[model samples]
Target: MKIISSKIVITVLLVFATVLSFAQKDFQGQAYYQTKTSLDMNFGGRQMSEEQKKQIAERMRSSLEKIFILTFNQSESFYKEEEKLEAPAQGGGNMRFRMMGAGGGEYYKNVKEGKLIQQADLYGKQFLIVDSLPKLNWDMGSESKMIGQYLCFKATAVRKVVGGTAMPFGRNNNENQVEAPTEYTVTAWYTPQIPVSQGPSDYWGLPGLILELHDNNTVILCSKIVLNPTEKEKLKVPSKGKVVTTAEYEKIAQEKEAEMRENSGGRNMGGGGRGPF
Candidate 1:
């Protein structure tokens, strides 16, 4: 009788272990990130009163601040902006600005398959950018810091800056142009405790989960993390867009912008241009 009882106990233990393994395999997490971009209000050597500058800054606030969410499992993740109602432009006839890159639409990454799929709505058309995951050569540093409750390690990478300019307010002249940076020095902070190689936007390839990222004038920081949440996100690759590679998409955008400029007789279009985001 004693031998029989011991065998029964062992069998139950094995069954529990098997169920736990399955649960671990399907683990999912959600991370909330707050993103902010700094604007350069230099005014191009033109003297402007402090009150005017403040008003201009207020006009740009809607495009500068945002919240995003990253839903992930072991190999698949989706990053997207959390939808919220933006305030109307403060001044009447003020043009509302939105940046084109990063946080455009849905961004999906499959680390195990080395694939990237992005859904972008550009020029009144939807485009799916199908490309390999960006190959970033991360230089892991010894520096460490705490973001929220996680201890994060520093990493750096160099990449070409994404170029786009915002139309200067109240001026159609070329002299007041604000040049986008030509190079991007990205600094990322990742926490090994999470053991997932995922980050906001196009940043990844770290040994752990990235909690903070600094790219040129923009900063993305993780504010909250929920491991194995109640509602699991179905990580589906986005499919609602015209198929195009990254280069093809960029060429199309440039051509469309040129055509708009030519049609408008080389004048700014309703104060519209890419904002710093």
Candidate 2:
């Protein structure tokens, strides 16, 4: 009887310890992010006057800057664009160009379940792109930086960047296409205090929440963070769209994009008139 009583006491103590640990950890929060892309107008800069280039840069700036909100809890996150802006359309003129990038969809990631759902649209067609959650193999660094009073530690990872190349110098009408992935180093600064494996877009697998991320010409920084806010947060999984695997959606997207470009006679710029989802 005494041995059983001691075992019971030990079990009770263990349960109490687990409860304390869980209560102290924060798992709910909202992170506001601002993304900025540095435009390279060098392609047509020399051909145009200084004033014209400035105007183009201004337009690009307006298009490139965007705001996003990422609400997360523990191992799940939902990221969405705050503003849905219309893509610029060109009306058959001398020059045809527009800023281009990805991530115009409802992004949801569940690290615990190893699931990722992206509600995407390509040329008026809706698709639910399903794939595994992004897993970044990070090399933690001793270097540190402060982002909005939160002390963040630096980490780096080599990631494959897809769809980087643009149409070469030519009419680009009836040219072939195959998007190949290229390797690029991604730099991130995360705060360990938050203890959530999350970042902007398709980046994850850090020891903490990533505060700032840099990838080539684009940079995403966390502007604000609210931990366990008074407002109720819902990080629900999205389930409304034409479901398709990542490979399937890629094939469909490429085919649709090619068809649109051909239909527009190279006049369509900025993803061939695809709207932000």
Query: Could you say which candidate leads in TM-score?
Result: 1
User: Could you give candidate 1's per-residue lDDT for residues 130-241 as a string of tens digits?
Assistant: 9998898899876776787666778999876433454433235455565555556789999866777898876689977899998766788899999888878798788998
Model 2 scores what on Cα lDDT?
A: 0.67
Count of clashes, each model? 0, 0
Q: What is the C-alpha lDDT of each candidate?
A: 0.71, 0.67
Q: Give one digit per residue, the lDDT tens place, for model 2 in 1-277.
A: 6755554465355445444332544657889988887655545112666886677666555446888889987788998888666667533233433333434678899888988898876655678888897677899866765687676778998865433255422246445433334667879998766767888776789877899988656788999988778785788677778998876876666566556556666433333212232
RMSD of each: 9.9, 9.5
Error of 2 at 42 (Å): 4.6
What would the TM-scores of all predictions be? 0.78, 0.75
Give per-residue lDDT, candidate 1, residue 254: 60
**What's the CA error at residue 115 for candidate 1, in Å?**
0.8
lDDT over C-alpha atoms for residue 93 of model 1: 38
